[model samples]
Target: MEIKESTLDRVKRLKEKYALIGQDIDSYLDGLIYANPLTYWDYIEVDSLLSLQKPKTDFPDEKIFIVYHQITELYFSLISHELEQICKNGKNISDAGQDLGWKDNLDVNFFIERLKRVNKYFEALTRSFDIMRFGMEKEQFTKFRMSLLSASGFQTASYRYIEIASTDLKNLVHESKREELWNADYHEQLDNIYWRRGAVVADTGEKTLTLRDFENKYLADFHRFADEYQPINIWKKYQELSAEDQKNPLLIQRLRELDINVNVNWPLVHYRTAVHYMGGAAGDEKGTGGTNWKKYLPPRFQRRIFYPELWSETEIEEWGKSWVEEVLAESLKTEEKLKDEL
Candidate 1:
């Protein structure tokens, strides 16, 4: 009799709770009669994700290329998640017009942990390029690449968003172009962003299809994000830290690691892949995107330094040049050796 009464009381509480949400307990139970238990595959949408790797070509190796890029984009999404959280935390401490107040002294360790997570994600991405470098046969890649005209990875909006969220908008503009746009507004400076400048037609100096399409899809969204993040980006958030915290070696080390991981290391590995497949004795094969990839892909040429304030003047001046030249020279030698063996 006591057990029956306890069960009844529990049901009565559940019914009352459901009533608050305009739901009938009996109706919900009736619906549940036909419901299935969730499975791992269903929860993670494994089928849907597997279906997304539809290759443009029938070549077996093309699937590897497509899937690797998809994996990289997923990693980018993960980094963006951490960055968004950091931005939100920063905003909480110093919302639009409010002064820093006591809240601005919020813990610096939290930001350091989040930044370290971003570095780890980048490390994973940098290491995974090995799959791209060694997985696909050069001949098959060359053939299938033609099918992907004007569809370069340069069109990755998330990559651009990561850059915009990491630093002030002024820092992203090329040093040479920044002076000319020194007094220009944010929108104008954004127009001459370093990547946009790199995406121009070499001869005509006009925007390539890749850049134009990216701008059409994401320009307004990027503009809004830049405005929102200008005050709360990681660099600015670091500045908000206490004087001693600002000089924390661990914090500064993470910043420098992020700069190298994103700007120098990743780009160098990617450029190595390009050089292996499209360059060398194979001749000047154009990139699928139609940009001058030789010039555009290299870190030395792009010089996309994220944290300029952290590096010395000489380090900034010699950024990406020596290491890039060495890598390219090595890649060229490997290609030459392959030809000689054949």
Candidate 2:
């Protein structure tokens, strides 16, 4: 009898809680009557995910190409999530009239952990470029790639967001253009971002269809994100730390790891893949996305270092050069082998 009374009491509590939210207990119970039990496929939306890889070509390898990019975009989204959480944790530092030394309120360990998570996601993505580098049949990929004109991974907005959220917007501008925009507003500087330099015609120096389409779709959203994150960006939050905390070895190590993982390591692997597929017998092929990728994709050329304040002058000067040369050498050998096979 005591157990029966306890069960009735629990139901009564649930009914009272539902009433507080303008829900009727009897109506909720009636709705539950028709609900189906969850299955793994339904819970995870496996069918919906599998349905996304719509290939433009009938080539069997095209699906692998499509799924690989989709997976990379998902990883970009994961990094973005961690960045957003970091911003949330530090938002209180931006409150009106708050003390400038607001790092005391922020949790340094929490920020480091979140950054480590972002690095792990990047590590997964950097390692996964092998799938793009070798997973598809070279001949089939070359054929199917022609079908994707002006649709390059260069237009990935989430990847852009990852960079914007990771550091100050100034750090993302090209080294040549940084001086010109040094005193400019964020909106003006946005026009001169480093990645925009990647999507221009080599001869005419005009925007490609890929860049124009990206701007049309995401320019406004990117600006909004920039404004929202400007005050709470990781670099700015790090600056808020006391000088001693700023020099913490663990924090500095994570920052440098993040810089290399996102900028150097990922771009070198990607550039190597581009060199392998596009660097054929005719020398540099015009990228299907319509950019001079040989000049644009390599980290040495792009020089997209996020934490420049952490590195020495020589390190910055030689950024992405050593590994890039190694990758290019390997790509040449691979290209020669492919030619021999054909």
Name the top lDDT candidate: 2
RMSD of each: 9.9, 9.6
Please identify model 1 stretches exceeding 4 Å from their true place: 1-36, 90-106, 321-342
* Reference-based lDDT, each prediction: 0.80, 0.82
TM-score of 2: 0.83
Model 1: which residue pairs collide?
none
Per-residue CA lDDT of model 1 for 1-80, tens digit only, reads 35798888988987986787677899877877989999999999999999998888989999999898899899999999
Highest-scoring model, TM-score: 2
Candidate 2 stretches with Cα past 4 Å from truth are: 1-34, 90-105, 322-342
TM-scores for all candidates: the values are 0.80, 0.83
Candidate 2 residue-pair clash tally: 0
